[model samples]
Target: MLMILLAIASACAYGVADFLGGAATRKAKVFRVVAISAPASLAIEGLLLPVLGARWEAGSLGWGAASGAASAFAFALLYQALSIGPMAVMAPITALVSAALPVVVGLAEGDRLSATEIAGIPVAACAILLVTVKRSAGVGRVRPKAVAVAVLAGAAIATQLIMLNQAPHDSGVAPLIVGRAVSSLIVLNAAIAVRRRIDPGRPNLGLAAGAGCLDSLANLCFLLSARHGLLSVSAVIVALYPAATIVLARAVLKERISRAQWLGLGMAALGVTLLALG
Candidate 1:
């Protein structure tokens, strides 16, 4: 059950980190925000590595580095989406898609879930469509480009899980170290390409660094969670991260989601409940 707790903790931390990242984007370019945040996350992960008494094999480092590349791409997309759209809607859409892909892979790999769990798949799918319906000037609408990116972002998000889950059981924290290092390099390169300063401006510093730390911690929680539980189950719980971002939107941004979004949220909850039971 410790895995369950860690999964939930990962979800919560990710939610808050997404919220903070979105807020930081308002003050700086997304690339700049991501660039600064990556190192903060790396610092935390580095500190925790020894404290956790982790060790890894050479092969695991190679594989773990792949996860880093995948996650770096996914996070770039996620931060990009969060910077442009309503975080309340975007967060859930990204998470649901991320969760669904792994479950599909699990099924393909011969893992089975109960019938009730299977039913949740459709419900979650509907929710993804419903949640992306955005509003502008009192009109409800959806942007195809943003919607498209959101879906792609979800797929990218799933890669992080799929790759990390494949880490050699005895790999210790090697995958995490390699993964985060790769992500940092990606963000740094992106920032350079855009001529964006890697350091956050004074106003953006706190939010940027905080987001990075939380994100790093979230990844740690998920990795530890996977060590104790099924990846499918851990992914499901962690996918609930949107809940935290939604709360932050309402409280911090004073944003109200569309009615359709609320309904979608309900459906997502139903889906998660079923997944949990399954």
Candidate 2:
């Protein structure tokens, strides 16, 4: 229950961060947005360093760096796909793919679920797709090439999550700090490649920094949750973040609420209940 709550909290944090990131992207280039946000997050982590209360051993740092590399690659691919493909398709693909591998790993290790829990897996995954579903037709086609890139991005996200989960219990939040640092560096390189300013302009810069702080906090929540409970459950709960994103859209963006999104929300609640019970 504690782990489930933690993962849900992580999702809330992530959902808000994503909303902010998306808003920032509309104002600036993806790399620039990420570059500013990632470091802003790192700065907060640096401040929290003294109070994290864990031994920062080499092993933890190594795992954190590895996770960050995979995450950076994932972010790059995701941003590329978002730029090229229609978001309705790309968002669901990336979210579902990112959540898929951890479930596979957990099940393969012989974690048993009750009937409802088994049902919840597909239920939750489907909800993600529904939340990302566009009301009207989009311009981009789901080409084989685009699908391939989306899959790769998803795989990268999965790798990052699984690797980050490997951090030893005593490692504390150091993994977040190191992993976030590496990710920030990757974003900087991406900004350089695109010839975009690393630091965004005033309001955008402020927004990115705020979003970064939340993103870092979300990662920490998931990291702590994974260390506390089954990765399968943790992943599923965190994956519900799309629902949160949709709710935020309804509130902040004043986006029209679709019947499908409403149904998706209901399904998500059902899925969460089953998973929590199981």
Candidate 3:
């Protein structure tokens, strides 16, 4: 139950952060947005280090770094896909792929689910699809390239979860923090090399910083949850972050939510409740 709660909390935090990050990308360069966000994340993690305490082994460090790099790559690809693809198609597909990978891995690792959870999987997938579904009057459809990138991003996310699962149980949040910092640096450098620009600007700087801080905090919570519970279950619960994003988009972006999405949100909630109980 505690793990499920932590995962929910992490999902909320991540949803907000991702929304902010996506918003920032509209006004700033993708690389710049990520670069600024990365340092902000590092700062937040740095402050939390005292509270979380440092407990890391060499193995944990390696795995954490690997996770970070994979995440950075995922982010890059996702941004590229978003630039060229429809959000309605790309976001949900990527999210579903990301969510599915850990569940599959967990099943492979002999993690058993209750009958309720077993049913919840398809429901959750449907919910994810509903949340991302957009009603277009015109003839805009999903791009194949965007789908490919989203799939890759999902694979990267799954890899991150798997690596984190392999991290030392007693390593505290140090390995996670270290991994995030390294990943941020790598992303920052890549952005610099590719764009040859580093403009933080005025308002966007603050937004990026805030997004990074929230993201880092969310990552911390996710690591803590994974350490305390089954990785597959934790991943599934945390993967529900997109639900929050959908709700926020409706409220903030004035986007219309379909009847299906409302139904999806309700189903996702029920599924999560069953997961928690399980």
Q: Pick the candidate with the highest TM-score.
A: 2
Per-model TM against the reference: 0.82, 0.93, 0.91
lDDT (10s digit) by residue, model 2, range 1-278: 88878988998898888888888878776677776788899988888788886568987898899999998999889877877777777778888988899899878866677787788888888877777677556554578777778888988888887888888878878888889889888878767876744444543887788789998888888888888887887887787787888799889889887899898888888887877887
Worst 10 residues of 3 by lDDT: 194-203
Q: Could you give candidate 1's per-residue lDDT for residues 98-148 as a string of tens digits?
A: 988887776676666678767766676665555545654632455666677
**Model 3, CA-based lDDT:** 0.79
Highest-scoring model, lDDT: 2
**What ranges in model 2 sit over 4 Å off?**
196-203
Ranking the candidates on lDDT from highest down gives 2, 3, 1
Full-model lDDT for every candidate: 0.77, 0.82, 0.79
Q: Write the per-residue lDDT of candidate 3 for residues 204-266, one digit (tens) a residue.
A: 887788899999878877877877777777787777787788788889999777897888789
Q: Give the TM-score of candidate 3.
A: 0.91
Superposition error at 207 for model 2 (Å): 1.4
* Candidate 1 regions with alpha-carbon error over 4 angstroms: 78-94, 119-133, 137-150, 196-203
